[model samples]
Target: MKDMLIDDFQYTAQELLIRNKSILDLITKYQDSNSRVNRAIIKAVTQCGCMTISAHKQEIPDDASLDEMKTSVESHIEGLLCENCRDAIERDIGRNVFYLASICNALDLNLYDIILKENDRIRMLGKYNLR
Candidate 1:
């Protein structure tokens, strides 16, 4: 039963990752564009929560650090998501973290170490997304 539960959680994590990747890809494609359709897509991406018209005027710098971009996008999204959507997104993130922690515990791995390693990898890569 424990194994089955782990498998279920793993599946959920995978599904969430896939969905998140698609959203990130879409965001990447439209984030720097000024096309009307891209603007529409960005608005839709936020589910029309509270994205202000002024938000469309702010442009992400081409030379901004990945962390900067991530922060900007996340802030924008957070501001735009409805209360319920924000809650759901937070819950999903919590679930993913819980699943990862469970797996690390099963393997006797330190979660903090894993986080540091991943942070180093991201720093080396110099590119990351909202997810």
Candidate 2:
């Protein structure tokens, strides 16, 4: 299984999902249907923030007044969600990207390159109505 901490581990998509299955399930169980969709995106941003903090070995001070951790978790995952249902599409996108990246890394594929290429292709051949 690929370790999120390291870049060297090889993990298949199914394997990685199985490892983080609890988080996915938690999102579904705790959040409403709308939130469920965006949960993945929220998780992505959260994971990115967590990874940066971990990399810098930053710690929340005991005297810290604000819940920085909580804020970080909610960044880019609150306002854009469905107003009526509170779904976080950003979080969902992030989660999907993170998962895809891990799997691609395992397969020795370039994540950024693939993303850019696909994005360009989509722009060139837009089909579906955005809303």
Candidate 3:
């Protein structure tokens, strides 16, 4: 597998965000279920202040119902989001996955190897200096 620079990964992430709608559509169609994607979406959305990471941590009033809490989360995500930023975040997630896959293929290693041998992996990653 070919090596990818960190810059390339960053660039790809940006590109993915720019094409956010397309990525969402694909996710809807494919039902792709990966936690990283979910995390990236949350990270991007939170970064844009569409919602706070600690929204759930807020104290709920005794009068508030479960439905209200759910609604609050939805409203936070949908009501205040920056469309451009959200799109970009989705793209960043896709780019990250692509980068990881490329590295795995190049090294003939699996995800377990990368996670378990992170220091070695980082050293290998250091080989591809930024262009």
Flag clash pairs in model 1: none
- 1-131: candidate 1 lDDT, tens digit per residue: 65566555545544544322354443442333324434454554546645433334446689988777766552333346556545655655554465454455445566666666888888876664234
Best model number under lDDT:
1
lDDT of 1 at 32: 30
- Candidate 3 lDDT over 27-72, as tens digits, reads 5423343555676567655565565543445555678666665454
Best by TM-score: 1
Candidate 2 clashes between residue pairs 3 or more apart in a chain or in different chains: 34-87, 38-88, 40-91, 40-92, 41-90, 41-91, 41-92, 42-91
Q: For model 1, give the 10-residue run with minimal summed lDDT.
A: 25-34
Q: List lDDT for all candidates, in order.
A: 0.52, 0.46, 0.51
Off by over 4 Å in 3: 1-48, 55-80, 109-131
Report the alpha-carbon TM-score of model 2 versus the true structure: 0.31
User: Predictions ranked by lDDT, top down?
Assistant: 1, 3, 2
Taking all chains together, each candidate's TM-score versus the true structure is 0.38, 0.31, 0.30
11-64: candidate 2 lDDT, tens digit per residue: 334355544445455344334444556544445346433221123344556665
lDDT comparison, 1 vs 2, better candidate? 1
Model 3 pairs whose backbones collide = 13-92, 16-91, 17-87, 17-88, 17-91
